[model samples]
Target chain A: MDRLVESTRELLWERGYVGTSPRAIQQRAGAGQGSMYHHFSGKPELALAAITRTAAELRAEAERQFAAPGTAVERITAYLRRERDVLRGCPIGRLTQDPDVMADPALRRPVEETFTWLRTRLAAVLTEGRDRGELDAALDPSATASTIVAVLQGGYVLARAQNSPAAFTEAVDGALGLLSTASRTPRSG
Target chain B: MDRLVESTRELLWERGYVGTSPRAIQQRAGAGQGSMYHHFSGKPELALAAITRTAAELRAEAERQFAAPGTAVERITAYLRRERDVLRGCPIGRLTQDPDVMADPALRRPVEETFTWLRTRLAAVLTEGRDRGELDAALDPSATASTIVAVLQGGYVLARAQNSPAAFTEAVDGALGLLSTASRTPRSG
Candidate 1:
């Protein structure tokens, strides 16, 4: 059962929801057809389990950066600079491109909740920074948070489009640069 | 032949390369299988034609904003603020998520070229802005251009995830605000 769900996650990441099939999942998991059916009702159920797990993992990973010791900018910088599979793209963000995944609310909930949580969490960090006078008074925490999240998501798009991580790195650097301008503390070279 | 290519473009946008099928393309185009084969070798040929056309259209649309009379900030603002089908996502950017599309060099060429062109064009505009002393000396045109492009691409992902355009709008507004800080002339309310 674990292998089946794990294989579904891998296939979904590689081929998306519509392209992933029960046969493929079973084959990849080394589970027989009967074993697969015994585990889940169908592909949708299996996919939901996989997606849910992936979303949880993403949040846990991000929380580590957000909860780490740092100022708002430093925390965000850490998150942005953190190592990522730039080429494979964001597991949750990539699902937005899948018609099958987006059309189903059950499958889409995790994706939606994940972004909402990220934006809200980032905003809180920025708000804390502002209260501490670390960020400019003019910075809108929520809006800035969205931009920060968007950069990562969009960076993946650029990287995948060019088949190189260069674009993604440049985007992160550019975002960090712009974000620094919003810092109340004058950055030193 | 025209109808076939147009239909393929629409299907590719709606369903992506992997999900779209030749039969669906023919049916949507009102062209028979024979007609499809007559004009193109197969799905790959038809898809290339469609993607090529889509890439061209995207460039033309973006060029209008980039070419309009405006300051560097205003031009970038115009490009970012231009009314878009926020829910549908970017025609060209969306293709980056299609694994099959990315795997094929011929298919991926237009996607790569479009972004390279967009980044170069945006960098040129930023360079002009910096040269005119409209932007800060510290700005890196190439990297900043990638961030701008990434925001749009990432904004689409956000909007689609929430099934609302609000995230996309917020991202743009946030980006514009961050960009304003880099302006030499103080922004007026």
Candidate 2:
């Protein structure tokens, strides 16, 4: 049972909800029909568990970077610098592109929750910075938080399309540059 | 035959390359296997036609906005303001998420060519602005061009994940704000 769920997670990350097949999961997990069926009703039930697990793990890792002691700038920079396979699409973003996953609310909830938590976490960091006068007071924390998350997700898409990690690096650097600009007060000199 | 190809183009845009299947295309196109195979070799061939067709159209639409008569900033601002269904994801970005598509150069060429052409096209416009003294000579045309593409691609990911268009808007606004700053010469009191 444990192995079946674990294997689904790996396959989900690699193949997405639509591309993955029940046969693939059964084969990868080394489980037969009886074993998989005993643990769950079917593929959808198994996938739900896998998505929930991945979402939790992703959020925990992101929280570590955001919770680090620093102003919003350092924490976000740290999050971006956290080494990633730039050419690989984000697991969560990849799921959104999966027509099957997006169509089924059962499968979509975990994905929605994961990103929701991430945006909130990122927004908190931005809010803290704004309150401390470390970020421009006019900066909308929620909107800015959404943008940060979008840039990283979008960066992966661009990098993969170009077949070069340079695209990802340039995009991230550009985003971080925006952060630096916000930290500096604009006053008529 | 033409109807099948057109159906495929619409399917690719909505469901992505991998998410789409021959059965779906045929079903949507109201064509049978014999009709489809007579028109193209197989799924990949049909997909290639659809993808290439889409890439050409996307480029034409983008060029229309970028090449409009105006200062570079005005043109780019219009390009960004162009109405888009952000949560649906870019047709090209959807291709990037497909591992099968990325692994095959023949399938990948149209996508690659589209973005490359887009970046260069945008750069030329920016360069023109620089030469005309509409934009600061200090601007790096290539970097800014990549930034523009990244923000739109990334904005789609954000919008899709959050299930809100606000994130896409925020990211676009943020990137535009940066471009606006870049266009302005350094302030002197």
Candidate 3:
């Protein structure tokens, strides 16, 4: 990973899109202004690179969960069960809260694409489970996929608001319960 | 609403709790430094007033939808259907995204209270329906209430990420559908 990309990621995590500045990124990266500008046109260009790189990593991480050898239920449950710092919120979802990021199409494109790709990928995984008879054939894979994503994102919001991770866990648990309950082939109570 | 309080609310909305400054508020409110200090000791007082006022309005809005004359399904559905600037996100939920707001108990009190109050109020309405045979007695009203709120907050995150309202509506529709499906008490299919 390039130093500039790493610096942008750090700035993004700390100051957010609105608060971050190009000069700050250059200083953080240990690169002079010319060196920074040589690699990217400006802050938007640098931000796009950082956001896309983050998006790729997110996909790869999710793929690890999706590709795990287990029942569809086992895999998805494992995916949701990944260790996360619930208090910090999702880096991608956190950008949604920043007005500047949302206002800029260049920045928003990667964020939008990431979630869109995630939902599609998740739905595909669910579809395969339904096909293999691991999940209920009656389940709406796409809808369930959206619900899964919503629970995670919404859990962050609830947890952040309360300044406790309890709400995040509850929401996740509730969504998982829904999936199991709604499963055509119930495993066990 | 005093000039200072009004200014505080507007600034909180635009700059958020962390980004807003006393100097900016005074400038926007067209008040002198001494006059601003005279009305409120500092940012904390002004912010508390602003947050409290915002919470009250948010509750009133929810009550308007939840307390409307209709079946329980109708009322819940109405609440979900209420028009919103999905892109802008909920004013209360917006506070949750602010690090400073969540860190300070003084700042977080209204936000915490707002969601707590919303969940309680929603649960009460749900419980009423359970008693009246409009909903399943087996339903966990409080948990379901929390999930509904989560969906709205998450919808805002999705919408902002996409730079469009589509994801927000999809999330809302998905949650509302869950509510409909969960209703053991029959509604027209």
Candidate 4:
């Protein structure tokens, strides 16, 4: 049963909701149709489960970075520099490209919640940094956090488009360079 | 024939490659099977045409901003702030999420070329800016151009995930803010 969900997640990451069918999931999970149906009602149900799990795992992975000991810039940089499969794109972020997932409220919820949670979490970290004088006082934590998150998601898109990680690396470096300058400046965060 | 190509592009935007079937394109284009078949041999051929046309349109649209009179910072900001179908996502960027599109060189070429052209065009403008003393001499044009492109694509993903344009707006603002600070600073850009 757990393997079913895991397999579905992998499929969803690679193929998306429209491309991921129940038969594929069953085949990947090594489960019969009877067993698959017995476990979940249908594709959507199984996808919802898979998406929910992915969201949770993403949050947990981010928490590890956010909770690590460091100044706000250091923590944020660490989060940005956190290891990622640049070529594979993000599990949750990839769902935004899935038409069926975006069209279905039930399936979209977990994805929406995951990004919202990420932005909020990142913003909280920025706020702490600002309070601690690590970031410019005038910086908008929420906006900056959103930008950081966007750079990552967008970097994946660029990399995927080019079929190379060089563009992704450049985007990240450019963003970090800009942010580093902000931290050093005293005016207009 | 032009209508067929245009309709195919619209369906590709809404449904992606796998989801956009010949029947759907035919129906959307109001062309009979005979007409669609007469114009293009199959889905892949039609899709290639559609993607190529789309990539050209995107480049032309971007040229409007890049060619406008302004400082490098101003031009980049205008490009970022350009009007967009925020919720729908980038036509080319969205294709990166489609497996079938990414799998085929014929299909992927337009997408790859679009971004490559975009990054290159943007880099050229940045390089010119540095030469004109509108930007810091040390700024890496290629890196900054890639970053700018990333923000736009990433902004679309963030907006779609939240089902709101606010995050997208925040991200653009954040990127622009960072750029503005860099422009004002004495550091190597």
Question: Arrange candidates by DockQ, highest first: which order?
Answer: 1, 4, 2, 3
Considering lDDT, which of the candidate structures 2 and 3 is the better prediction for this target?
Answer: 2
Q: In model 2, state the lDDT of residue B179.
A: 62
lDDT of 4 by residue, B106-169 (tens): 8888999999999999999988887888775657788888888998999999999889988899
Q: Whole-model Cα lDDT per candidate? A: 0.92, 0.81, 0.81, 0.87
Q: Model 3, range A1-189, lDDT digits (tens) per residue?
A: 299988999898899887789989989999999998888898888888898898899889999999988877778888877888999889888888767887888888899998898788888888988898766565777766766787788888888888898887777665665555445544243
Quality class of the docking in candidate 2, CAPRI style: acceptable
By lDDT rank, best first, the candidates go 1, 4, 2, 3
**Model 4 CA lDDT for position B174:** 83
Candidate 1, true inter-chain contacts retained: 0.74
**Model number with the top DockQ:** 1
Cα lDDT tens digits, model 1, B1-189, are: 999999998888777787689999999999999999998999999999999998899899989989999899999999999888999889889888787899999999999999999999999999999999998888889989999999999999999999999999999998988888777765444
Q: What is every candidate's C-alpha DockQ against the true complex, given to 2 decimals?
A: 0.55, 0.45, 0.39, 0.52
Alpha-carbon RMSD, each predicted model: 3.0, 3.6, 3.3, 3.4
The residue ranges of model 1 lying beyond 4 angstroms of the native Cα positions read A22-41, A186-189, B19-27, B30-39, B186-189
TM-score of each: 0.91, 0.83, 0.88, 0.88
Error of 3 at A149 (Å): 1.8
TM-score of the first chain of model 1? 0.94
Query: Candidate 4's error at A28, in angstroms?
Result: 4.0
Model 4, A48-162: lDDT tens per residue?
A: 9999998999999999999999988888888888888999889889888777898899998998998889889998998998888887766788888888899999999999998
lDDT of 2 by residue, A87-181 (tens): 76677777887768878888988888887788789889989998999886767778677667777887787788889988887777767765666
Candidate 4 docking: what grade?
medium
lDDT, model 3, position A46: 86
